[model samples]
Target: MANEIFICHNCPMTRTMATIGTKWKPIIIYTIGLKQQRFGLIHAKMGLISKKILTEQLKELEEDGIVKREAFREMPPRVEYTLTDKGLELLPILNLLTEWNSRHHQADFK
Candidate 1:
């Protein structure tokens, strides 16, 4: 155990961070958490995000078993993003953090 020196080959925290620590992932999670949304809706809420970042974040979340992506075969094709059971579980965590920030750092912010 002493020689382990905290190796991080596929560690859980590393994996969690890899999935949610990016600037876009939490925003994407929060956006989709409100309700299932199409690509445009998420993009509209986060106007500053580029298409490349949105695409990357969605793909990562889907691959990480957090977000679900669905596509419809309409005339122009339709797509939607939603949180999975795992993804939905993150909401309470985010909300708690929000409450904590409000209590502790409200003055630090406006």
Candidate 2:
């Protein structure tokens, strides 16, 4: 038989983690937030992520169907990213994780 794509231990949660478990992926998603964001603006907001890494991460997110990337044909050229329906589904989960972290580390959170 063909190799099973996911064993019993590797389930949907594991798949989700595989998709967004990177150190920067979640932060990227949160930074994008509710509105579409341009590449330069996102880089400015993130500050720490190098341009190369950000580009790679955005490509991955776009490939995974979690982020939509649109390019405009204009003089300088422009691109924007927004969360897809699948990505929007993750917002509540990310919020809950934030709430949990705040609850556990009350001193650090405001």
Candidate 3:
């Protein structure tokens, strides 16, 4: 378990947490999750994210091996981002986190 961290519990949940536990990572992971989407698509979907921050965060996720990047060689070129198999595994966890946030926080996006 690389980067495994356990806190306040008996099991090692921190490694899982490390993947999507941060402020923007989980949001990004959850956004381009099911389908491979372009940077503009993700940016449009995530209203609050700025271009600079989005670029930085995407690079970080790419470095962490949780996200995959695909680029095309054509006029005007296109690049898309998608979750790796490891990143896909976090969907259910993100769903649970969203649920908990809804119940406890009351319209987190609002």
Candidate 4:
């Protein structure tokens, strides 16, 4: 027991951050919203993010069970991304954070 690592394995915050703690993860989740969106649409919504980075983030979110990827065997190989139930649960929290920032970060707006 003495040599066991203290990595906050049981901490909810730590686990949450581990799942969606990157600059784009939360934004990506928010962007996906309640409907499915294609990779191009998500990329279009977030114009500043590189395609490579967006692909990587989406893959991570899918792996973490926060996002669902649906690939179709169609002519153009259509792929869409949608938020899973676990990801939907984070929307309200993200909204609260947005409100908090709006109220508290007025100076930053300028």
Query: Which scores greater on TM-score, model 1 or model 3?
Result: 1
Ranking by lDDT: 2, 4, 1, 3
TM-score: model 4 vs. ground truth: 0.86
Candidate 1, residues 1-108, lDDT tens digits: the string is 644546565578787887799878888898888598999889999999998889888998999899999999997888899999999999999889778889879777
For candidate 2, the 10 contiguous residues with the lowest summed lDDT are: 1-10
Please provide the root mean square deviation of candidate 3 (C-alpha atoms, Å): 5.2
Scanning candidate 3 in windows of ten residues, the lowest lDDT window is: 1-10
The local distance difference test score of model 4 is 0.91
C-alpha lDDT (0 to 100) for residue 97 of candidate 4: 88
Q: Which stretches of candidate 4 lie over 4 Å from their true place?
A: 1-9, 107-110
Over 1-110, each residue of candidate 3 has an lDDT whose tens digit, in order, gives 44343333445466556645668888999999899999989999999999899998999889888899999997789889999998899889889978988887866555
Better lDDT candidate (3, 4): 4
Residue 17 deviation, candidate 4, in Å? Answer: 1.2
Error of 1 at 57 (Å): 0.8
Residue 17 in model 1: lDDT: 86
What's the lDDT for residue 101 in model 1?
A: 80
Clashing residue pairs for model 4: none
Q: What are the per-model C-alpha RMSD values against the true structure? A: 2.2, 3.8, 5.2, 2.9
